[model samples]
Target: MAETDKFAVQPHADATSQQQAHSLEHWRSHTGRNDIITGLRAMHVWLALGWHDIRQRYRRSVLGPFWFTLTTLVMVGVLGFMYSELLGQEISDYLPYLGIGMVVWQFISTAANEGCNAMIGAGSTIKQIRMPLTTHVCRMVWRNLVILLHSLPVVVLLMVFFGHSLTLEFLLLVPGLLILMLNAVWSGIVFGILCARYRDVMPIIGNLFQVGFFLTPVMWRASDLKERAWIADINPFNHLIEIIRAPILGTPIMLEPWLWSLALIFLGFAAAHYLMVRFRERVAYWL
Candidate 1:
C-alpha cells in the first residue's frame, strides 16, 4: 500500500509539470502572435499620423514646407565654406563631404531628439484612444524622414555644384539611407520607451548630443585626426556617414566601417525589440 501511494504521488507531480510546460508554451505563442498583429496594425496608423504631423508642422509658416529645404541649404553653404577653409581642402571636394555629413547628421539628430519624447508628445492621443504604443514612435520616425526628404534637394544642388562626376555608385545611397533609417527606428523605440519611464532621460540625451557634435567628424575630415583615427572607427555615426558619403563621392566604401555599422545596427534593433516586447503593456501606463 505504501509503494502504491508513492507511485500515485509521483505521477501526479509529473502531470502537473507537463501541464505547466504546456501552459507556458501556449502563453508564449499567443503573446508572439499578438505582438506581430499589433505591430502591423500600428504601422498603418503610423503612416496617417506621420502625414498629419507634416501638415501640422508647416500649416502656419509663411514659406511653409519649403522652409526645410531653404534652411538646410543656408546652413550647409555656411558650414561648407567655413569648414573648407579650416580643413585646408578645396571648396569643391570639401563641400560635398560637408554637405553629406551635415545632411546625415540632421536626420540622425532629429530622430534621436524627437524619439526621446515620441510617446510623451502623443500623450493626449494615447490617453484618449486605445492604440498600440509602437505607433507613436513609428510616427515620429516617419515624420522626421519626411523632413529629410524635403531637404534632399539641397543635397542634390550641392552635389551638382561641388561634386565630382556622378556615377552608378551613387545608387549605393539607397541601401545606406535604408540602414540609417532602420537605425533611427530602433533608436527611437528604445529611447521613446526609456524616456517615458524616466522623464530625466530627455535633458541628459540632449546634452550628450550637443557634446557629440564636436566629437563627430561632420565639419572635419577623418584624415585630420591621424593620431585619433580610432575615434571615427569607434563612433557609429562616423561609420554611418562614411557609408553614405563614400559612394556618393565615387569612392569605394571601406569594409571595416561598413561591417562595424551593420553590427551596431543589428545590436540596436535586437535590444529595442526585446525592450518593446518586455514592456509592451507597461508603456501605456508610463506615458
Candidate 2:
C-alpha cells in the first residue's frame, strides 16, 4: 500500500513539473524578448516556406513562374482595353490604372482568402511541435508577396508603355506596401484563429472576397463611378488601393483614405491581438 501510494504521488509530482515548465516557456515566448527572437526566426522560416510554395505552384509547368506574370499581363491588357472602350476612356491612361488596381487587388484578395486557413493548414505541425502561431501567418504573407513581386514587372511595363512619368511620389508605394502587409498580418491572425474554430468560415470568407472583387474599383476608375463615388469612400479596400494608385499617378494621398486605413489598422490589430491572447492555448485542439 505504501509503495503504490508513493508511485502515484511521484507521477503527479512529475506531471506538475512538466506543466510548470510548459507554462514558463509559454510566458517566455509571449514576452517581448522572446517575441523579437521569434519574429526574426519566423521571418527566415517564412522566406523558405514562401519559396517552396512558389516553386510548388508552378512545378513541372513549361512556362513556370513566368506563367503568373504572363497571365496577369494578358488579363489586365484584355480587360483594360475592353473596359476603356466600353467606358469611352483613353486606353493609355486607363490601362495603367487597371494594371495597378488589379495588382493591388490580387494581394488583398489573396490575403483574405488564404489567411483564413493559415493555422488550420498547419495542423500537423502545430500538433507535432510547439511553434509560434504568428509564424504561419507570416508564411502566408510572404507567399502572397512572392506572387506580388512576380507581377511587378507588369507594373513597370505599363508605366513605360503608357509614357507615364515616374516621380518621387511613386515611392509612396513603399509605405503602401507596408500598409498592405500590416493588413495581411492582422487578417491572418483573426481569420486563421476563427476558421480554426469554425471551419465554415473558410467558405464564407471566400464568397465574400469574390463579391468584394467586383465591388472594388479594380478594373474601373473611381471617376467612372461618378454619382456613386461614396462606394469608394465606404470601402476600406478602395482606400488601400488608393494608397498605391494615387502616388503612382502623381496624385496626393487623400486625407480621408489615410485616416480610414489608419483606423482599420488599429482596429484590426487590436482585434487580432485580443483573439490571439484569449485563444492561443486552444488553437492546437481546435485545429
Candidate 3:
C-alpha cells in the first residue's frame, strides 16, 4: 500500500511542476506586451521627463537650445560651400540640399548614438522603480526630438536663402517624419537594451555610425555617384535621407524610398518587440 501511494504522488507532483512552468512562460509574454503598451500610454510621464532633460541641458544659458540652432547654421554654411566646391556642384543647388540633409542626419544620428545609453543611463531609476523599461527609451527619443525642433530654424533659413518656394508637395514631410520617428523609437529600444546588457556594444555602434556618416550622402549628392548611382541606391541611409531631403528641396519624391522606409519600420519594430519580450525582465537585473 505504501509503495503504490508513493508512485501516485510522484505523477501528481510532476503535473503541478509542468503547469507552473507554463504559467511562468505566459506571464513573461504578457508582461512584454504590457511593458510597451503601458510605456506608450504613460506619455505624460516620459514627456515631462524628456522636456526636463532639454531644459536642464541648457539651464541658465542666454540662448538655451537655440545655441544648437546656431551650430547647425554654421555647419551648413561652411560644409555646404566646401563640399559644393570639392564636388563641383552648383552652390545654389547644394546649400539647401546639404542644409536639410544635415538637419535630418543630425536627428537620426543623435537619436541612435544616445540610444545606446538610454537604459544604462537610467540604471538607477530602473533598479529603484517598477515602471516599464520602454519609458526610458521614449524619453531619450523625445529629448532629441526637442533638439530637432530647435534646429528647424536652420531649415527655414535655408529655404529662404536659397529662394526655394514651398509647394503642395512639402506635405510629403508629414509621412516622411512619421516613418523616421518610428524607426528611431525601435532602434533606441534595441540599442538601449543591448547596451545595458553588454557595455562594449555601445562603442561598436558609435563607430559604425561614424563610418556611416561619410558613406551616407549628407555633404554630397547621390547624383555625384553618376554611373555608380546604384551604390547610393543600395544604402538604407540614402533612402531614409532622400525621403525628407527631396521634399525640402522640391525634388520629385520617388516611390522606392517610401517602400524601403516602410519595410524598415516593420522589420525594425518586429525585432524590437521580440527583444522586449525575451529580455524585458532581464533588463533590470542587467542594469
Candidate 4:
C-alpha cells in the first residue's frame, strides 16, 4: 500500500512538471512581445519574395511594371488638365501636384488594401509551414514600394514639364517616404490579421479608400478649403499626403503634418506589434 501510494505521487508530480513547462512556453510565445528583431531577421526572405511578386505580376507585359507608371501618367495628365481648368489653378501649378500625389497615393492605397489580404492571400503557405507571420506583411509592403519606385519616372517627367528644379527640400522626401513605409508595415500586419478573422473587413476598407480619394487632398489643393482649413488639418490622410507631396514640390512641410505622421506611425507600430505577438501563432487557424 505504501509503495503504490509513492508511485502515484511521483506520476502526479511529473505530470504537473510537464504541464508547467508547456504553459511557460505557451505564455512566452503569447506575451505580446515588443521587438523588431524577428521581423528584421526575416527581411531577406521577404525581400526575395517581394521581388518575385513584382516580376510575377508583370511577367508577360512588354512594359513590365512601367505599365503602372504609364497608366498613372495618363490619369495625372487628364486629371491635372481638367481639374486645373475647373479650379482656375495653373497647369504648371497643378500637374506636378497631381503627378506626385497620384503616384504616392497608389503606394499608400495598395499597401493598405493588400495588407487586408496579406495573411489570407498567403493562407496556404501559412498552414503548410512554420514561419514568422509578419513576413507576409513585410513582403506585401515591399512589393508596393517597388511599384512606387517604378512610378518615379512619372514624377520626374512632371517636374521637367513644369520647369521645377529639384531643391535641397527634395531630400526631405526620403524621410517622408521612410515614415510612410513604416506605417505600411504596421498597416499590413494589423489589417492582415483583422481581415483574416473577419473577412468582411477587407471590402469595407476598400470602399473606404474609394471615398477617401475624394476626401483626401490627393488631387486637390488644401487652399481650396481656406475657410474650412481645419478639415484638411484634421484629416490624417491629408497630412500623410502632405509629408511626401510637400517635399517633392519644394513647399513648406507643415509642423502639423509632420507631427501627425509621426504620431500615426508610433501608434500604428505599437498596436501592430502587440497584435502580432498575441495572435501570430493563431493566424493559421484564423485563415
Whole-structure CA lDDT of model 3: 0.85
How many clashing pairs does model 3 include? 0
Local lDDT at 178 for model 3: 81
Q: Clashing residue pairs in candidate 1, if any? A: none
Q: How do all the candidates rank in terms of lDDT, highest first?
A: 3, 4, 2, 1
TM-score of 4: 0.86
Q: Where does candidate 4 clash, by residue pair? A: none
TM per prediction: 0.83, 0.85, 0.87, 0.86
Give the alpha carbon lDDT tens digit for every residue of 1-287 in model 4: 99999998998999999997985554335323632446545677789999999899989889998888889988888988999999898999788888888888888899999999999999999898666677788899889988898897668767876788777888888898888888888888899989999999999999999998888887788778889877777888888888888877888767888899999989998888888777877788998
Error of 2 at 21 (Å): 15
Question: Which has the higher TM-score value, candidate number 2 or candidate number 4?
Answer: 4
lDDT tens per residue, model 3, 43-103: 8889999999988999999999899889998988898789889988888888888888888
- Candidate 4 backbone overlaps, count: 0
Q: Which stretches of candidate 1 lie over 4 Å from their true place?
A: 1-43, 60-62
TM-score of 1: 0.83
Candidate 2: deviation at residue 151, Å?
0.7
How far residue 138's Cα lies from its native spot in candidate 2, in Å, is 0.7
Ranking of candidates on TM-score, top first: 3, 4, 2, 1
